[model samples]
Target: MKISAVVVTFNRKKLLLECLNALRNQTYPLDAIFIIDGPSTDGTPEALLECGYIKELPPKKGNWSWETKNVIYSPINNKPIKVYYVRLYKDVGGSGGFYEGVKRAYEEGYNWIWLMDDDAEPREDALEKLIRYMNLPGVIALAPTVIRPTGEISKPHRGILCFKKIFPMIQIPLDESKYKSNQPVQIDFVSFVGPLIKRDAIKIVGFPKKEFFIHHDDVEYSIRLRTVGKIYLIPDSVIIHKENIKKTSLIKKRFLGKTIYRIPYNKLWKTYYGTRNLTYLGRIYSKSKFKFYFKLLKRWAVSVGAIILFDDHKIKRIQFITSAYLDGLRGKFDNEKPKRILYGGKKE
Candidate 1:
């Protein structure tokens, strides 16, 4: 199968290099490598240029005939493997990057697209394992086991796992032995990092919603894909996540008249996206099941309380939380983009 690996990166040049090296060493041959860079001042572009493995391509054409031109441009001197970099001046966030990457993959006529973060370094045989398991019937997307820097393997939500009214921690076994075997397990959701998506799935469900910016965009996409086909977690495939884990409260709070919350400095935006998006998912599912609506409300409430009491931006956090809930109630699909912060900017 022709597989195109799409990686979206920000300012982590070192980690991005590690990830690219791992990709280059993959057991399965890569058809193409596309990197979507959010204009980095960190010399990442120069580093990528130095790598030599990547072939720089220009921005995609905006016309309808762009697909035909892309196909013609896909071949690099008749070589099957091609590499390209796209630099975006506006920071559309990770979701935007993903959407662009997937669209490019499809335009290039790749049968499968492997999505990864700049920090995700897969095991040597990760792609091979996923490709082998993807041959199973009805499997549309396959994810590898995610490992932390501490050598602990992160687990995905599998089998009938349900959240209570409040988004309480759902504990499961972290033992690697449970997942060491070469078995394909069914899952309700899987992270976008290091997953192989069949082109057919993308055609059926479409790319993730770019408006989500970064958070539950994956969840929303996966759930919709599930309707057309199943998503699987292949235990034998593994990838290491090289980023630091930042904890942010999953709730929003309303205080005074304005929304107050810390703009995710490093990786805290994931928390905001997760909380807000999950609330939206709960409401979406609640249309048929009343319990899901109540469960979503309960979780949103708990999240708000957590932010108000624990998060540093208590008042702003409350405002964000309230806004999210009210928006969800009103079926708001687009999340308002947070104001950009300038260096030495004015405080709210």
Candidate 2:
């Protein structure tokens, strides 16, 4: 099989190198590795060149361009892995990087595309285990169990999206016991971490929505993927996610025996994109307009309450949240507003 891997990276050069090294040592070798650079300013290009990963830096071709380089895996093994380095003019976020990477891999006629971020390093046998399930009946994509460096399962990386009344559209992480015997557990949602997706599936659902910029891009993509075939979580196939855990900025309160997380003022910028994207998804998935708007109103009320009770920068946060909900309802997709709000930069 023509198996290729796609890695999306931003400003983290060290993490990207670790991820690439892990890819280099995979038990089941890959034919190519696509590096989607988010036009990083952290000397990532120079570092890659220093490591002999790429012979030359790719020229900027307008806003987006790519250059291909071939480097032998090692002097002893002498396996060649083609590396395609794609450079963007600006940081369009991981969603845009994956969109570009997947499109290129598909166009190159790769049978399967392994997708991940620069922070994720797969186990040596991860790809081999996933390859074993390629012929499984009606399987379109397979994901490895993602674990933090501390060996705890990363809950958000693999889950089943629940649409029940109690937890509507919430993602429930799979129980470890279910896949403990090395069995593949069927799941409706998986993140971009080490998921091997078949080219045929991409042909049907198309590439990921690039406008998402930062959040919930995987959920939206996974929802579309469910229309084609099953997505499985392989327990034995593991990847270590090395993302630095940030300190929680949200206030947590137990209400009615449920923990409610309230967004803080500083994190409102992120909340905007997440709220907008999720609201957009709800708009697409909800059967009734009344229910959709009702749910949206509840969310807005919660935001207002959070601002009033536990947050600062009250007016600005509310304004951002309100704009998010409204833009989402109107299906207005772009990162211009959020950029202006966060960086005080004008839209291009």
Candidate topping TM-score:
2
Model 2: which ten-residue window has the lowest total lDDT?
Answer: 162-171
Candidate 2 RMSD computed on C-alpha atoms after optimal superposition onto the true structure: 3.3
TM per model?
Answer: 0.77, 0.90
Which digits, one per residue and each the tens of the lDDT, describe model 2 over residues 1-348?
799999999899999999998898888888899999988888998899998788888664555566656664733256788888887887788889999999999999999999999999998889988999998888999999999999888877788776532113556777767668667889999999999999899999999899998778998899899999999888899999998865476678776788777764445566577788878887777666676778779879986886776666676777778889888878898787865665465432
True lDDT of residue 52, candidate 1: 63
Taking the tens digit of each residue's C-alpha lDDT, what string does model 1 give over 1-348?
Answer: 689999988999899999887887777768788888865668786687566644343343322211111111222134445676777776677888898888988888999999988999998889888898767889899888888878777664333234443243222323456576667877766667787899998998888787777766776777777888887888878899876755353344456765545444333333445555666665555344566666656766786776655566565556656656665566564534322211122322
Off by over 4 Å in 1: 53-80, 156-178, 246-271, 287-315, 333-337, 340-348
Clashing pairs in 2: none
lDDT of 2: 0.83
What is the alpha-carbon lDDT of model 1 when measured against the actual structure?
0.68
